[model samples]
Target: MKKILLAVLVLLTFIGTSCDKVDDLLTFYINQEETITIESTFPIGVVTPLSPIPVKTNSSETFKNNKTRAELVKDVSLNKLTLTIADPADENFDFLRSIEIYLSNDKGEETRIAYLDEVPKGVKAIELKSTNAKLDKYIKGETYTVKTRAAIAKPITRDVAIKAAMRFKVTADPI
Candidate 1:
């Protein structure tokens, strides 16, 4: 009986250590790039939803590079989201007040993934706070949508083109 208990304990220890190693090996990052355009006549001080951008995840390549598949993907979350003015060399984020970004798929369900309430002035680039929401279903799908809502603090004379960079942390099981 003593020998049987010792064998079980050893097996449990090995399983725990192996699970940890598998988790570390299967974790990786996926990045998506998008663009948002704001016309010069946009309304200020009121939250407005911008056009939803269609996204083809192309995550299969990333999964292949990481040695995992979508079926093995377990958890996904926004790690970092950055926005920068890509056009009009002299423009900055000073004209912005607040912005929120959401993620959705064909199911029509939407969830906020990143946002910023107080935007700093005189900067060409800004990083929004991540919501850290679980995003397994969204990332696993072949396509999804990025929806943005923003409220401007001031008016702009020319249309602004902003580039968005979204980085997501993906955890998957070893195949």
Candidate 2:
């Protein structure tokens, strides 16, 4: 009886220690979500080709807690994207056809991130949410650029305002 009890105590100790190690391995240090919005005006009487629109620049402050770009690329993920037409009710709303978003670096390289082809008429907002596990090779120091294409069924005499909102989640090792 003494031998059996001693063996059981040893097994329990080993199991407990193994579980603790697993917990340590599974621990995550930092998890956060961030949202950014970019807006531009589609000028009247001008059909803008596929070109870069104004978007927020990535600053050192973007990577808080002394995080490195390598760490951010490993941990960052795009969660949701939303596009809104601030003047959807305007007379020229139907002329606005589609918008494409791209990730661009200072080197002039670009990667298309999101595309909205057939925007529902009269709708003010559209959400392009995704369940994808990772961003498409997003690197640090990259900024977002928007390309808008419009097909005018009729001529537009006024400008239209457009906005995009991007939401993402990031997990990193705590500083």
Candidate 3:
């Protein structure tokens, strides 16, 4: 009878240990949802979103620049577009994964100005929720229109948006 009791005790212990191990494994499989947040800065003398600036896009309604549906602004010096991104809800995001900036020229051509590794003259790019970068090259007084959007590598349906804060600093410069 004692031997049988010992065997039952061992079996109960084994079941308890097995259950604990399974619980741990289940906890490991659970994952938390991730998110990202990007912020921009509009300086004291900067132009702001008085209204919804229309985004120019192609025939498919994808964000692009061309004659029709082209995003535009007055000609401002390169010194005026100071901005930054900060306070990402998730720090694990690939911040530098894919980003692009475009400059519109006199001929109404869209010029690719900057990307992940590059920031245009007077433009600054930094990571953090509340950081600031200045575009000293864009003179304050000049007027310029710009189009900016973030590029996501995953799929076209994904909404990857960034605020293109353009502030034409008031200065005595010509466009």
Candidate 4:
């Protein structure tokens, strides 16, 4: 009887230890890096006020359900965000005085994720990197909208097309 009891305790201990190791492995696998890119066009010939420039992402319609944004992006972190101007390079590009980027959720709440003011002359790209920015607040399956407000140094009579692209580096646990 003593041997049997000892064997049972040992088995329980082994199982507990194995379970903890498995949990750790799962966590390591879930925390991974993903890149999301969005592209759009904005007319910047004139001094345009902060406008809602709709940007599309990889959100899938099939993934939409009753799941909340927090549930979808639980334990996720946004590592970096980059904005690039594809067109109007060098002399062709106008001087951008200020720019602001915002993310809108399903409930229509807009959250500012990035901002740049007094941008350097001839700069075509801007990058925002922070460890504290949590992008999980935006829904996964829903088509979250990205709004942008840009100010140019001068105004023109004709519309000058300014192409913009956004890239997001996110690390999150697998759902």
Candidate 5:
């Protein structure tokens, strides 16, 4: 009985690892980068929601390059999202106590994709935690909207521009 159990466990392990390898072969990444600005006169000590910014997706081109179409896509999720202060040469995220970034489609379907709580000070760039939400439709679409809600830590005298970089992991079936 012991030998039988050990053999079964070993077989299951091999099958699990093999499945992962197959998935890896079908996986690819698509990166999207955009710049957003926080106005200098923006108020402090409030959780404010920013206006939704529309973004055109490059998924069609990326899909073609990967030899896959939107219909063949099996799953899409955010791999990573990073925020960096782009303007003012020497500025950081010190003014932002926390921030949540949302993605919405044309039909108004929305989901939280990434966020950073208790943002570190004196740093030029920070990576936000992914909500692990499935993003297939949003990425497959031609355009989507990005909205942000942030807890401001301090007042800003000048507009602070931030570059938001997002990488998405996509798995699809071969055509």
Candidate 6:
């Protein structure tokens, strides 16, 4: 009976020692950090051409042998007009601001008949660095001429911002 008790005590002591050693080797892992980044891109604008307008012609009256006669004719033609704006190619994204536009005549002189104080109601404004802008407008023999040009009026720019996202991962043994 003494021998049996001694054997049981030895077995219990062995198990206790093994459990303590396993606890000492166990460990835990953790991760803590953040990253930041910036990204940028330019915005583009588009414009469509306007349809042609027809003009009506009037006739002069003639009298012969106490009789008067008059005649009139209808004239139609396609008005080819195009509106163009230069791309702002200034330093890294400086064209994000504003753009100025101007109108000039065929003699290389500026014209007041065709003028734009700001972007027109239906026209879209694009952001790009450039020196000249050309546009097409209908002429009724008064407001605009056959050869008119559009140019840059003032340099415009605006501030822009961009951001990027990232993720982190971790793996470790538990204590």
Best by lDDT: 1
How many Å off is the CA of 81 in candidate 1? 0.4
- In angstroms, the error of model 5 at 40 is 0.7
Candidate no. 2 TM-score: 0.54
lDDT tens readout by residue for model 2, 91-171: 323555555555555556665556566556666677653434454234244454544444333345555555567665544
Point out the higher-scoring one by lDDT: 3 or 5: 5
TM-score-best of 2 and 3:
2
What are the TM-scores, per candidate, against the unseen true structure? 0.87, 0.54, 0.29, 0.53, 0.92, 0.17
What C-alpha lDDT values do all the predictions have? Answer: 0.92, 0.50, 0.32, 0.50, 0.91, 0.26
Q: Which scores higher on lDDT, 2 or 4?
A: 2
lDDT of 3 by residue, 55-160 (tens): 2212223112212111222222222232343233122223233444454433454544444433232233432121122322221112223444443222222222
> How high is the lDDT of residue 113 in model 4?
65
Please give the lDDT score for candidate 1.
Answer: 0.92
Clashes of each: 0, 0, 25, 0, 0, 16
Q: Cα RMSD (Å) between model 5 and the true structure?
A: 1.6
Per-residue lDDT of model 4, residues 1-175, tens digit only: 9999999999999999997675444331112122222223335444344445454444333223212223444433344555555543333334566666667766777776666665666555556533345565563434566666666665444443444444443333335
The Cα RMSD in angstroms, rounded to one decimal, for candidate 6 relative to the true structure is 34.7
Residue-level lDDT tens digits of model 5 in 31-134: 98988789887778887887678999988899999888999999999999999899988898889999999999989799999998899999999999999999
TM-score of 6: 0.17
Candidate 5: list runs displaced more than 4 Å: 1-7
> What lDDT does model 3 reach?
0.32
Worst 10 residues of 1 by lDDT: 20-29
lDDT ranking, high to low:
1, 5, 2, 4, 3, 6
> Candidate 1 vs candidate 3: which has greater lDDT?
1
**Tens-place lDDT digits, model 6, residues 4-43:** 9999999999999977565433311111111111112223
- Which stretches in model 2 have alpha-carbon errors above 4 Å? 1-51, 54-59, 65-73, 87-93, 129-139, 142-144, 148-154, 173-175
